[model samples]
Target chain A: MTSFVGPELTNPRAERVKAVRALSGRSMRQRTGRYLVEGPQAVREVVRFASVHELYVTAAAADRYSDVISDAHERGLPVHLASDEVVAAMSPDAQGLVAVANVSSATLDDVLASRPTLVAILASVRDPGNAGAVIRAADAAGADAVVLTLESVDVHNPKTIRATAGSLFHLPVVTGIALDTVTDALRAAGLAVLAADGSGAHDLDDLLDVAGPAGAGDRSAAPDLAAPTAWVFGNEAWGLPAHELELADAVVRVPIRGQAESLNLATAAAVCLYASARAQR
Target chain B: MTSFVGPELTNPRAERVKAVRALSGRSMRQRTGRYLVEGPQAVREVVRFASVHELYVTAAAADRYSDVISDAHERGLPVHLASDEVVAAMSPDAQGLVAVANVSSATLDDVLASRPTLVAILASVRDPGNAGAVIRAADAAGADAVVLTLESVDVHNPKTIRATAGSLFHLPVVTGIALDTVTDALRAAGLAVLAADGSGAHDLDDLLDVAGPAGAGDRSAAPDLAAPTAWVFGNEAWGLPAHELELADAVVRVPIRGQAESLNLATAAAVCLYASARAQR
Candidate 1:
């Protein structure tokens, strides 16, 4: 075991911690192409994803998570011992583990070139949790890609990343692509573009019924699950902006017969994405 | 305009603001049988629901909402001017209007005596938003009542109330009941108890299908719509406790073919509730 570091120590043995703290902001995250992970859960996920550029553990936590630390260390990942003060300063809810990893930063061209079948486009989603959940849902639905408009919350935001439950590391999520480009590219790919609208013309169940089973044996009867399709989700407050809705091949609403005015943005996105998955099944 | 003159304002005219601020907590809310409404939107909702005990608005907000305030006042409700300081102290996000309204508490007797067809039982749900959304969904699905387990978050929590989008005022939401009493009473009422589990033996869709349509012309094929049925949603953190699961007549799960472990609690509840509504429809 490494010699016990004094708990009160506050020397900068690693410059990466500072770099990571700076990445907390949107500008810094964009510039550095790095994102921060906080607490034991996120740290464990980062280790599983094995994309850790730098890892910081409090001396006490290091003792507790020696296995995780050693695994990352074996991969030549930089490991630093942070004083409790440092950890507290770095994480609002520090459960004694933190890590920073470079984001995948996949491009739209890369996603389109793959001839993706299932995809989700988020236009101006504001909540970090919703943004993260959409990406996570997109990943779960086996979407070939997730595209984000410029106005959407940064996927790398700590809250957003946490909400993804580490699926963000696995999913091919791309941001800053204009809605027009996405719509045209989807059209070019022969994929139907469906937007989730609060006041949509058709019921979501109807769309799913038409799409057929995601993994149905009867190819002719199925809506062709392998055929490229993009499910678009909008912001929680105002929903999909009208201009973006114009690009949709079909507008669908999740039939909410309930008194709840709206579902949480993330929940709505999940329902839509899952509907697509169920339909294509 | 009536002048405020409560403990909140040094000036006698600010008493109205003091009364509104006093309703922030449960004890005070119960004492006065009143609760505080925050934001212009919530005030509008309060007015629409016809439960506004008193209305308080800042000068600027009153100017913008003169029609709304005047209408409520013409209905013989008191409209008072709250200084900016009063509204700020009353509601952090006052958004220019606040209202003090009678607490619309629903009791078990109130729920059962109504002869509800569909009821949702919330078992220890801790998140305000989740609880509020569930209640709102219950309202949307036309559920007769929402029963909360003893440990569940307060339905009247501002965040939960706000999440309901004013459905709290409209919906018959009951809390502070023992699990056994509520479950047994529901059973006695001839309501089949269906609990939502993340990995239940039955899929939600399948359960809905098996239940058949409510009130179909063929009496043998479909259950009567007026027959009582209760759907149970568990806590957000740990989900339905094992013992609670055993109490349920049947367990149902929303199938997830994706990588996500589970849907958010509110989303899961909404889906299940909506599925039941759809089956009945």
Candidate 2:
């Protein structure tokens, strides 16, 4: 049976605790090569999937999420039992459990080598929640991978991780690549790169209707949904700039039947991804 | 041309400013029957689509958003030009523009009387952002209206208003209705009620496959997406309760082809609503 290791970390102001908490900042995360995964759900996922270094939890939290502790111990990861005050000092949003994990990611070239059929690329999407939501949606839609441009929010940011709801560990997310580079590489790998924007020439529904063998006549106007495809979603505020829009093979708009100006970044991404997944199936 | 109505408001600590700031509180809003709409986008919408009580903007913001002010004036609205500090004090996130508008909504009966073809119901969804995002998606899907159960977050919450991104004024949102009443009423109005859950017996994509007249076999088990329909989305954390699920004619699950446990509330709602919207079209 796995048990708590080491003496109880009782000091809230300890240097180790401070270092762990400091991972919340980008500089600290970069210098230490580690990031914080807060809350039971995320901590469990990190322990199960990522290369986790350590874990800290209060006595009650250990009791509540016994399986998490058991799993961590099974992985030979150090599990520290800390005082409630110490855990509180670690993170207010952690719900009494947190972990220090290495900042890990898959490279674009590596992911492209696998010849992924469905991919989602986020361009300059800085909002952590929006970025994380899109990642989760992409995963749910059966996308092979998600690529975030260099300007996008950090996937390891606590808010982004939390928004992902453990889905961060479910899929391969490629980060630190430029948008143009990503489009070029994916296109070379035999995938149609489509951009989602309000000003798109084709409506998403019309494309869905003409999808698969059901579509007849001149199909040159629209990209095939059954083929390998990648969707590029712009920032939450200003949509894809004209130069970026031109990078895609074709631009498709989610049909707006009501008076809404547009759907939020995450929702629109989900719609487009699901539509493609449906057609491919 | 309509210009600033009177002397500029110069005092950030003035009673009027504090009164406006206090509108952010639920008690204050309930007492005054008004809610705060922050940012130029929302303020412009409130001025155009709702009964606005007051407009507060700095001279710079007024000049930049001259159309919002011009439209407000055209509607016989009293516009107040305030100092930067004064406007900031009124609401920090307003971006130099804010409005006070009456808290308005439609009754369930009234919405049903219009013979709506599509509707979205949020059941016990306490997250304001989730509630607002669903409303925006519903509007985008061309749903006739949105209904929030009594236990749902107040639609007038500033965070909710911000999440809607000005779509709050585009469609009628009915609040304070119970889930049972919403389901019963919508079903009676000739709309099939569907509850979205992870453990649903019917897969959403399969239903879409067999939707409309294209199916050769008996379609009695599945709810037709092309028919008038209402979708009930559960809370973000805990999905619909057993009693709530029992109210729907059919329970549908969004297919999860990846390791992602589930899609977030808003994205799932958007996918389902868009599916229905496409089928209906």
Best by lDDT: 2
The first chain of model 1 has a TM-score of 0.85
Deviation from native of the Cα of residue A189 in model 2, angstroms: 0.4
Which DockQ values do the candidates obtain, in the order shown? 0.39, 0.89
Question: Listing candidates in order, what is each one's chain A TM-score?
Answer: 0.85, 0.97
Question: lDDT of all predictions, in order shown?
Answer: 0.73, 0.91
Could you tell me which 10 consecutive residues in candidate 2 chain B have the lowest summed lDDT?
Answer: B213-222
- What is the C-alpha lDDT profile of model 2 across A20-91, one tens digit per residue? 999998889889889999999999988998899999999899999999999999999999999999999999
- lDDT for position A270 in model 2: 98
**Candidate 1 chain B lowest-lDDT run of ten:** B3-12
Report the Cα lDDT for residue B188, model 2. 82
